[model samples]
Target: MKMSREQKYRLIEEAGEEELALLKQQVKQSPWRQKYHIQPSTGLLNDPNGFAYYQGEYHLFYQWFPLGTDHGMKYWYHLKSADLSDWQDCGIGIAPGDPQDSHGAYSGSGLEHEGQLYLMYTGNTRDNNWIRHPYQCMAVMNADGQITKWDQPVIREVPSGYTDHFRDPKVWRAGEQFYCVIGAQRENGTGSIVVYRSPDLAQWEWAGELSTSLTAFGYMWECPDYFEIDGQGVLLFCPQGLQPESDKYRNIYQSGYVIGDRMNMNTLELQHGEFHELDYGFDFYAPQTTEGADGQRIIIGWMGLPDIEYPTDQQGWAHCLTLPRELHLRNGKLLQKPVPALADRRGSKASFSGRFTGRQQVPDFAGEAYELICTYTAEDEQDHVPNEQSAVTAGQASVFGVELRTGENEKTVIGYDAQTQKLTLDRSAAGKPFAESYGTTRSCVLDQPLRQLHIFVDVSSVEIFVNEGEAVFTSRIFPSRGSQGIVFFAENGAVHLQAEKWDYL
Candidate 1:
């Protein structure tokens, strides 16, 4: 059912106690509730916002619509964690009834200054004519965890050349000055990023549109994040209205990044390379990153996409945040590995090691919420010359992988094809189906030989890190509760394999 405008914009306070209680009951009854990932208790969650480490803890926020399970009247829902494995919910961090954020509080980033964390975000307001007017807003949080929004917007009106689509201000400090990059669209209908300069968090000045090679990319660019890793600059953003080209941009909206030399502060120009997707899966968007206390760059993405109706909507909640990943720049590509701290949540362990030729199932490896690590190596053959025919024969057996959440008539397959040199995730028969038009299988070509698979499976989602994060696939699946089987298979020939599984505590 489509939500009416009034229903969509209703404030949480306007809801009666019975209505709120019923919503909570519906969410608790949902079978798809996440085991370890950060999901809303009620209503909708999207776009990780204001992620930063401050005052001996990690502060993370997301755009939340608490009244229902649709994108309506977003508030900044807060969570804090001493370790990334466990999160403490802090309720609504920023409500949206003020004049600036009359409609909603949108996405942005967080920066820690002297003894405080500064949150810079987009305040979304709609006028009587139903047109958007976005404001670059600011709020400050003390070490005591109290937050206060400024009485006025830091950046008031949209600049001259861009449309009202300007939003998502990501602020960073360079040398003695603070800089911000905002997602924008030109009057000519092309997507771009704009820059703003501020010495303090309050007063700001428009520098100019960021100069990049991408002149006409998409219709709108949202959630722009800028950071430097190992002296290389990376700009991450979600560009909407992209048409599918080969295996790229397969989703309705795409979240990706471009790496290059650091931006020229004076000219605001970025000399960068091509855009590469952060995750290749059915559900990933609006990823936000923050540097840990030890200077490790870590990221968390919304585990669902925009404009897609998920099966969890009927349960009164939708979407979750991906497990936090540690980012590394290796050989000109960003490699993402699940944070090492996650090992703290590991429970009972299981292991299997052998030369397997066909399908094999380990009894202890089946579970709903667990982590699995498997490594495969081709067995060597003496006196057998490596030729095209021999390679073809080997490829047949090399086309091996695992099936997860298997039941009588459903399973999700994560397999690698040596012949095609591709890693594929197929959820066609996984469970209750939605978004079939977008296809069920997503595959990525591997530049190197496949050696390992590190997988994390929750109640309703999966995150696969292939070959030590050379490529990653993150997706949400809706399988029946009885589907708790894990099977491993190889075709035509024997291969050496070692595997381990650990249930999440």
Candidate 2:
């Protein structure tokens, strides 16, 4: 058995004055700041934790290493929002509050038991001999969302074959019973998920290991999340150290899901079919899932990759959550669509409804870094105007510009690509629009079924949710200060665009 969290609490210590000073300095100098979305404060942030809803407000907790972004003493950073666009930081919610967690308060989940909020987390510690210790624990929050220290760990360590690399507790309700899933590293260095059952929020009994993987899954599982959606179960996880099998696993790490049958607590076995990544992008990991008021299962992931250089470090801050996505299991695969609640940010009233046509951009509404969705005909290949090798042949993208403003003359651009059936991201278009791959294109499979792009941009990032969110392309773009024009262009053909704009103020 692992040391109880009560026993682990004796090792707590405030990070040294020098250590804390360094953290403050780094917070003031995060490389990703000024150009992208990040938690308002500093420190190292990883994994979206304790995402839950209570009393009508939405809460999002994250694994925060406040001593800069280098994974110092871990804490839980709290945020609350009524709408997804505007978020408020609630400060450190949980920390190395107990001796056993002197090392870190690892990732976990938040649950609503009765009227109170319950937090289940991993109490990570290091012994005098420097061996890693992880104790499974739970904490309760009063009506105010404040934690009353959970003195003891409910499950101390993994069974014999599992190592101390166990954490990331995801809890949910099954009928009248409370169940939890945790990522684990086996003694043999394999990744798997363990299960537990609890009648109330406090007491837990090990149900068994719910799922396991072979060598390809890497040595340890990071964030493990499971939920039922559209009559099917989806298990999401991030497996570390997985070598590329082929063209996949090409990123530094991968966050994906497996569509499976329900977890039979009695058998502790997962009846799974296929596995697919949640997003096909360079930065996405440690995803967390929570249920919405609409009875929808929505997921949010850390959009910053580990070991990757984030240019914003000079400004301070590292990563951010990708836009919230509503998860659905379509044909044995997990499909993520941006939540419908986001479109509510569509300000200035919707225009050009019922479909129309034109060779020009919409009138009266002109702004860069805005959202546009419209369906119209491309005047055909012969209708396009010639410009360099990129001639806009009728019916295709000849000119399109969505910009974001920082200074009087600064913005980012995400344009359309008709020849390649892709969308090009123009991070350099504001000034040096001709930089190498100045306009980066990505496959977006737009046709009759998906003729429009629901675009969202925040100065330095663009998330194009196409076909009502069926397919999504999220990337980071940094435009120069020389251009702030929200311009659009078309060739001889026409396109009817229904545009919406919002200030995330």
Candidate 3:
């Protein structure tokens, strides 16, 4: 059911206690809820915002619409963790009812200064004519975890030459001054990023649009994040209106990054390389990153997209944040690996090692919520002669991989085609289907020989890290409750396989 403007903007306080309780009950009854991922208790969640390590814990917030499973009346829902693995809900960090954020509390970043955490985010307001006016607002959290908003927005007006589509401020300290890069659209409607400099976090000066090679890439860019990794600058953003090209930009909106020499703060110039996607799967967007206390760059993304309806919406809930991933710059490309803290959630373990010629299911290797690490080494053709007992003639496997969440009539295949050297994820029959027009499969060509696959499977989602995060695919699946089987297979030839699985605690 489409929500009217009144319903969409209705505050949670306006709802009766019975109504709120019923909504929570409906969400609790949903079968697709994730086992370990951070999700909203009820309503919609998107855009991981205000993620930072503060005091003695990691504090993360997301854009939340508490009343329903639609993009409406957003609040900054909060969660904190000493270790990224176990999160404690803090509830409603920033409610949107003030004049600055009358419509919603949008996305932003977190910075720790002088004993407190400063939360800077976009304050979304709609005028009487339904025109959007975004404000860069700030809120402070003390050691006691009390959050207080500023009486006025730090940035009240959209700088000239950009439209109201401007939002998502990513702030960082560079030397002695703080810098911020915000996603914006030019007056002519093309996506761009503008810079700002703040000396004390109270007064900010417009630093001008960031200079880059991408002059006309997309219509609008959202959630721009800039950071330096290993002396190289990487800018990550979600650009809307990107047309599909070959196997890239297949999603309705695209999130990716460009890596190059560190930006020249004096000139605000970013001489970066071509943009490369951060995740090549069905559900990933608005990813935000923060440097951990150990100096590791870690990221978490909304495991869902905007304007897309999911099977869980009928249950009065939607979406979750992906498991935290540690980012690294290897050979000019970003490599993402699930953080080591996630291992804290590992329960019972299973192991398998052998030459698998065809589809085989090992005992204790099947589950809906677990982590699997498998390596397939194509056997040398000269070593294995053709035999009637073998599945195919003597040669390396032409195609190989695993099937997840398999049932009698459904399975999600993550396979690698040796002939084309392409890694593909096919969820055409994984389960309940939506967005079929965008296609049900996604693939990325591998530059090196296929080696290992590290997979994290939750009740309703899967995060695949290939070859130690040289490539990654994050997607959500809606398989039936009974589809908990997993199978490994090789086609046309046999391959040496070593596998291990750990059920999530």
The CA-based lDDT of model 3 is what?
Answer: 0.92
Over the stretch 282-379, how does candidate 3's per-residue lDDT look in tens digits?
Answer: 99999999999899999999999999889988898999999999999988999999999899999999999888778999999889999999976644
TM-score of 3: 0.97
lDDT at residue 488 of model 2 (Cα atoms): 45
- Candidate 3 residue runs with Cα over 4 Å from true position: 380-394
Candidate 1, residues 324-387, lDDT tens digits: the string is: 9999998889999999889999999999987677999987989899999988765556633333
C-alpha lDDT (0 to 100) for residue 456 of candidate 1 = 98
Every model's TM-score:
0.97, 0.78, 0.97
Candidate 1: RMSD to truth:
2.7
What does each candidate score in C-alpha RMSD? Answer: 2.7, 6.8, 2.9
Any idea what lDDT model 1 has? 0.90
lDDT of each: 0.90, 0.65, 0.92
Best to worst by lDDT, what's the order?
3, 1, 2
Off by over 4 Å in 2: 1-38, 212-215, 244-247, 343-369, 374-450, 481-503
